[model samples]
Target: MSLGTRPAANAAERADNGAMVLPGRSHLRAQRAVKIGSLAFLILALSAATLLLGRYTVTIPDFFHIVAGADIPGASFIVMENRIPRVLIGILVGGAFGAAGAVFQTMLRNPLASPDIIGISYGASASAVFAIAFLGASGLALSGFAMAGALAVALAIYVISRRGSVAGYRLILVGIGFSAVLQAVVSFLLTRTDINVATDALAWLNGSLNSSNWDRVTVLSMALAVLAPAVVVLSRPLRGLELGDDAAAGLGVNVERSRLALIVTGVLLAAVATAAAGPVAFIAFLSGPIARRLLGGYRPLGTAALVGMVIVLAGDFAGANLIPGVSLPVGVITGVLGAPFLLWLLATANRSGQGG
Candidate 1:
């Protein structure tokens, strides 16, 4: 048995022999359950409010009436055409980013290893911007190009980092370097583009939900439908791999194969979110850490996904309504919020001597 469980076993054995046992273990599990349940409820409640709290203001009655096929004129159009698709897409993108971030962080055993920070999102952004500025790509074509770029970047980083074995810090360093280069490329492309194309590209790079619609929703939905299940199935191997390479190998996990699967899966999830929502700022980076804290550092993927959904939807709401006659992109709010968090993380890491 592991060091962590040995004491628990002793305590339980003593309790079985009529001695008093510590209650912290069960209490901790119960507390985690409560936290997870509470966060899930909060996400659902926020999503409902998102659908109802826009300028048009669909009342609860109206929302239910529309859901039940009553078709209440303007309310129905707003709900069906605008608000529903936006909210659904937000949830999908948030969940994808959140889950992908969690997987990356857990697999790498480093909180700073999320796709957004590690150049994957920048890869997608650069490719999308190039497609827009040079090839006049739009819609699904842009998304496909984005995914291809993300995958290529991720593969290149992996190849560079693998010197016998892929070290987490090595991967991160390579990713950061590539990310800066890609950003410069995007900027150069933007500067050379026509005004109208530049405007469209800039807005997309800012990562807004202004263009959310049914078609984008369908694409994200289809991606999640296939990839989410793969993630869930792979999570077991991931848990095994977390116990170190030798231990995972002892548990019959092919270490290199598992790592490759995880990398590909994570890249796809992050790429799809970037394609649909333009790299919605720090949702991927922030969501995993926040979810870990809330789940008491257990790496609860589902809870992380919910936290992501809440962040994006709530951030979108705040961006739109927090100021009069001014609307910010969802990414702007997240970037602003994430900067301080990143600083705090670095400060804490320094203090703890982790040097992340």
Candidate 2:
């Protein structure tokens, strides 16, 4: 009605549109800092606990020296020879799976689109099992099989996901179907193999750290050292993806290209992890949500990965020592712990009329 009212309206509109640097940024940074600190401390703590909590325990000072390259009769050997490699492998592989799972879920816009459910881990498991049983392979050769198998599984999932068009629901449904087929192949291969070979395959399938040596650590460390940096570089595009496909593309996000790149990155990360740790179970599926809850926030791939490393190492160690009679496989332990959460998710989905 009046010129003064027009100016006030315009000013109000501008204020709403303006970037005033919300307090959330500082909070996010604080969360980032906290997560980073937690990761570092957790790594140290897990390493120390792994070394010191064994049958032949060591004191704090002796454990420190043992890690710092001093010689103690049994302490040095255990720390250097046994604990360090295992801890390192757990951290690297766990982090990769967590990060990969986070990125994949964000891209697919579905919390259930993780590698474990979508046949990626099954792919690697099938391939690695075959290699171990048939070729009598161990060590680094198994790593190659795992990586190839995981990537192949990823490719198959992608093709199926893209069968008609790129619908999130369709991709997830197809992925479930693919996982069934992969599991059957894995089962058949184990049945046909020799007993000893089957034993080896079974050990790998269970995802134990009992056999984790320096060689496996070396393979995973190298993969993670490279892949982590790539993830950081792609963070911008990945963040854009959380806004949904249409919005992301409208922001010049190169939707298809970004999705493809992220999927490739995620598949490689999971494959490398599988190669190193044999699909240690639930880390990929559970890490992101757990990390989100821990931070009291949402998905941040790097933070999620760090949280993943902590969860896996902690779970693995706990499983080994927490119960005396059963030194369970890390995979079995995690699966047991994560089953309730998975059930909760299923119940929530059904209540919402969302198909599994």
Residues 56-123, candidate 2: write the lDDT tens digits. Answer: 77888997887677899977877777877888888888889899989888778777989988888899
Best model number under TM-score? 1
Residue pairs whose backbone atoms clash in candidate 1? none
Clashes of each: 0, 0
TM-score of 1: 0.92
If scored against the real structure, what TM-score would every candidate get?
0.92, 0.90
- Each candidate: what lDDT? 0.90, 0.82
User: Residue by residue across 199-220, what tens digits does model 1's lDDT show?
Assistant: 9999999998888999999999
lDDT of 1 at 152: 94
Clashes of 1: 0
Model 1, residue 80: distance off in Å is: 1.1
